[model samples]
Target: MNERNHISIREAIRGRITDGEWAPGAMMPGETDLAEEYGCSRTTVNRALQKLAEDGLIERKRRAGTRVREIPSRQAKFRIPILRHEIEAAGGAYSSRVAFRETLKAPGFIQSRLRLATGARVLRLHTVHLSDGQPYAFEDRWVNIKAAPGVVDAPFDIISANEWLVREVPYSSGDVRFSAMAAGQIEAQALATSLGAPLFTVERTTWLRDLYITTTKLCYRPGYHMRTEL
Candidate 1:
């Protein structure tokens, strides 16, 4: 019904588990029953359970139903960094430009990565983030139009797609990778670095439930460092 309703149901269920009313390994009531008990819609109950699952408080199985985890899972959560905020936090002015934008049939590699149909069309963008007017990172991104149709008309020039997606899209699951790679021609040019120079890189793919949303690779300027807290 509303945000508060969803949160209340989640907390109610969480309290049951925490207070030993629903012991560890106990099967949780189905969404239909929970909805009736809470006097809310089944969709609201589902959302609450989904959040609990994400938080590692419960486990959900296709046909086995939901249950409180015997031993709650411990997961390392990483927040997607906003490039502009990152630069500003470091006491540098932030700016960005979209170097390229196009919509075309996904390439073979892109199709495989996103698990798209052979002829699926995607909106592709190349952007360079600048700090103090110097190149800081180069981003190459592909958005699945079917999953995020709003991106078709979004203005990447005004606000980078990275920030836009983070605000507008809510992902259920995602994968991220960090590595070092020699700069390619496009990445080198965009980052204003020498070709073949070693660069810090990040690749991420996001999905909303079963639907693929976007995938992107960010190549950072040389000497860049990344830190995260567990």
Candidate 2:
């Protein structure tokens, strides 16, 4: 089915559930019935239901079929800003340099994070982001070679890995963490701050389907803040 039809059918199903036509704990219509109602193939209905399942609107089981949850799961929605946009918004010229880049054996921690086998090789990168010639953020990133093989040839020197990956890879899910930490000697020097100064840090891990994409940690200089409207 077309993308328009897919969206309409998904919205229709969601409307029914939210409007109480399908009450909490109620079983959803079978795929065949839903397809007939939407005048589409079962594949289209399946796709719509899959999206609802992913959004936590419904649950599906192999033998038990699909049902509306007693309570919809809470979902957090936020936009992942591009770094350049954020810098430009602050009225600063954005610039970055590849401080370090290499291909080597994945470390134990990185291997576990990406579920890679022993001796797996990964691409490592360290970057220093600048705003108007002042230090902004320090980036430490690792790319899963098995998942993004083409990254081996990407021109990271010209375009940052963060920007390139965001454009090249389509992620289905990700995890993000934010915290305040005292900058280490290396971090302080890279960020042009005093040693042990407080810095805001963000760690992000992304995946496309089951394939690991990349893991990155961004440590920002003092006074950095992240705000998002719900």
Candidate 3:
């Protein structure tokens, strides 16, 4: 019925899985049947099951139907954070500055990453996130204008590109990678740290179905740690 009801259906299904009502290797009920049982539409049931499958709690095969995962390789799905929320959660004043925003031809590396053709145009943004007026992280992001055309007119000065994209884009899939890299002169200057200081770097790429949305690299000053619970 309502969006809340839609989410409740998902939660209820997850409860059944976690409570062992749906054990590993067990076939889940048909979507029509679950829709009847939950008093929701088949679409709602399908959405819930899709999320479970994405989380590795279930498997869906054409012609066979859905089943609980035999050996679940579930990974924690971290909710991507708005910098304001992240800073407030840490009890720090949150602020952001847009250092650069421009349009340019997509580089070969980005084209390869997003599977775009050579010479495709993209919107590029460089931003710095601050906590308590201290440098916290630097964001280098590229957006596919063809995928998210609204980004061309977005005001990154008022809100971060990360926040805007998360709120506006309907991304279906993404991947994130984390590593440590030695800060170069530009990074060191932006982060106010010594050259060659270790910085925590996060690279993320997101897509909406087949449409690639964005690729972003967030490099944090020393002492940055990301946590996710099982």
**lDDT at position 175, candidate 3:** 88
Q: Write the per-residue lDDT of candidate 2 for residues 1-230, one digit (tens) a residue.
A: 47788888999999999999999999988999999988999888988898898788899999888999988875666667778788998899999888888999999999989878899889999999999989999999999998888888899877889889888885547899989889998789899899999999989999888788889999999998777642
Residue-wise C-alpha lDDT for candidate 3, range 100-193, written one tens digit per residue? 8899999999998887878888998988899999999998899998988889999888888887888888555898998999998878888999
lDDT of 1 by residue, 1-230 (tens): 58999999899999999999989999988888999999999999999998899888999999999999999986667656689988999999999999998999999999988899999999999999999999999999999998888998998878889888887785447899999999999988998889999999999999877788899999999999887643
**Residue ranges of candidate 3 with Cα displaced over 4 Å:** 1-77
Which candidate ranks first by TM-score, i.e. highest?
3
In candidate 2 the C-alpha lDDT for residue 228 amounts to 62
Candidate 1: segments with Cα more than 4 A from true spot: 1-78
Q: What TM-score does model 3 achieve against the real structure?
A: 0.68
Report the error of model 3 at residue 199, Å.
Answer: 1.1
Q: Is candidate 1 or candidate 3 better by TM-score?
A: 3
Which pairs clash in model 1? none
Q: How far is candidate 1 from the true structure (C-alpha RMSD, Å)?
A: 7.2
